[model samples]
Target chain A: MSDREVGGAAEAAAAVIPGSRAMLAVIARSLSPLHGQVTVPQFRILVILADSNVALRSGDLAKALDVHPSTLVRMADRLVARGLIRRSENSASRRETLIELEPAGLDVVRTVTRRRQRDLRRILERMTSGERAAFVDAMQSFTRAAAADADADLTSFGL
Target chain B: MSDREVGGAAEAAAAVIPGSRAMLAVIARSLSPLHGQVTVPQFRILVILADSNVALRSGDLAKALDVHPSTLVRMADRLVARGLIRRSENSASRRETLIELEPAGLDVVRTVTRRRQRDLRRILERMTSGERAAFVDAMQSFTRAAAADADADLTSFGL
Candidate 1:
């Protein structure tokens, strides 16, 4: 496309995307309390552990988060220091270490997630019920498509 | 709400939000070239210039971006160094400096934005036409609400 046409398309797209970039920033700001306690990467780790309900080996956690093993190790060290997560030797594999969320970590995730929910609920309340239903359906479809791409990427990596 | 109830609400909200957090990460990854050349905050500056179609005072740019003056200055310096943006003293006011996108900067913005549009279009293609229309409507509503909140905050700040 010509530069002018590209600019026009971008303006149109920007109008349609609902300022999601800004809303995401606002949501992140609302989670400042949790951020004060743990960085976003660490919080992700906690969330993964809370969601899985099982200890994950270090390599597995790194793979799941798409972070380098060394980066994950550093983040894990910080979380361990803060008592938000624990590192334990894997029973099934003597050479591997398992990462698990602590009670405190779970609490943090719960609190932050609840706050995010309340914030999102307020946003949804601005729309009519029909709009909300439509949004839910549309978003579900988008997420499904994105998840499929993620799965394909994982498969390529032999994950 | 009780903790359990809050947890349930959060889970439901998570299911409904279409993994926006992850989608954002994916989008950011797709813009890796732009990111490698300019940080996100710097890119926002170029976008603002492109959208306004006119030069903006440094203070006004910082205000629009919700960033600290020092931070904006640092980012501007980097952009200027890369020749993507230019900084000039305002002719009307010696104390004020104007920031404008260089041709290079505008080109970069257009390229990245077009790439983003293509990425979003691919995702939308996975949905039926009806779903795409519904999504556009829903996202428009959500963006309007978020913009209103932003305006309210700005007003409260006497900006």
Candidate 2:
């Protein structure tokens, strides 16, 4: 897996790229049961709201989600239909309508999170202590480094 | 960050949980530019097709994507309209529609991947050699272990 000629980034990418897909697969499986209940995009929106602990302006949410305003409107429309989220009355006239997660929306986040935690725990337990400790240390280091990077992506509904 | 009382899974989860969000943020940032060009859900479908390298049966694709049949059809409907993918004529009456990625669809996956690689490389390069090595080893180890786990998620469009 080491490409001496393509040192640094390319080699590093080659070494760890497979892990990205594996990690995503882990998350996706957690979302499987709720497939019909909520689309992936909707779930992301719910996560951001849950993390923020407050209603978000539609425009701000759209920007954070990296969707066009119209697209957010459309996605929000579906959420409204499903009653996972709703538009809060906005007293601030200059700002866009504020959207808030409903109790139902919180359930989706909780369900998937609980599932992922269980799966991750199972996998972690199977690893030798060296592998498990390395896994955790590397993950934490990467997160810390990436979060500090100005270029770190803001798109995942600000997840 | 260590929770002594919550050993094993709970402890491991604590160490790596933050990284999960950071890693997702990295991916979400890569997908940011494609926000309007392709909705996140739609992009996911295209990625599945691109990776598969052949027309996928609508039913199988739906199952692999972990989406309801009706939802896949709806998502595919937009993709078809946008010319990112198309329905291939299927001779077998028993099979559902076959979806093939168009040139346009390939382009989208390529763009995001290129961006993500560039971003990841930059991040990897900034790390100490030890950190980078741990990342590669841990990532590969985790991918291998998770892939082997019978309970590992299959909901991420077979990615």
Best candidate (score: DockQ): 2
Q: Please provide, for model 2 over B20-121, each residue's C-alpha lDDT reduced to its tens digit, 9 standing for 90 to 100.
A: 777766666677679678988799888888887999988887887667999999999999999999998788774668999999999998888877777778
Model 1 agreement with the true structure over A1-159: per-residue lDDT tens digits: 456444543444455443445445445555567746887767778877887889999998898778899999999999999998999987788999999888998888788766766776666656666666676676777677656566443221100
Q: In model 2, which runs have C-alpha deviations exceeding 4 angstroms?
A: A1-6, A32-42, A53-63, A66-108, A151-159, B1-6, B68-78, B90-97, B151-159
RMSD (Å) of each candidate, 1 decimal: 6.2, 4.8
* DockQ of every predicted complex: 0.26, 0.49
Q: Write the per-residue lDDT of candidate 1 for residues B36-111, one digit (tens) a residue.
A: 6886667778877887789899888888777798888989999999999998888889999999999999988788
TM-score of candidate 1 relative to the true fold: 0.76
Stretches of candidate 1 off by over 4 Å are: A1-15, A22-26, A150-159, B1-15, B19-22, B63-67, B151-159
Tell me the chain A TM-score of model 1: 0.75
State the weakest 10-residue window (summed lDDT) of model 2 chain A: A150-159
Lowest summed lDDT window (length 10), candidate 2 chain B: B150-159
At residue A79, what lDDT does model 2 achieve?
92
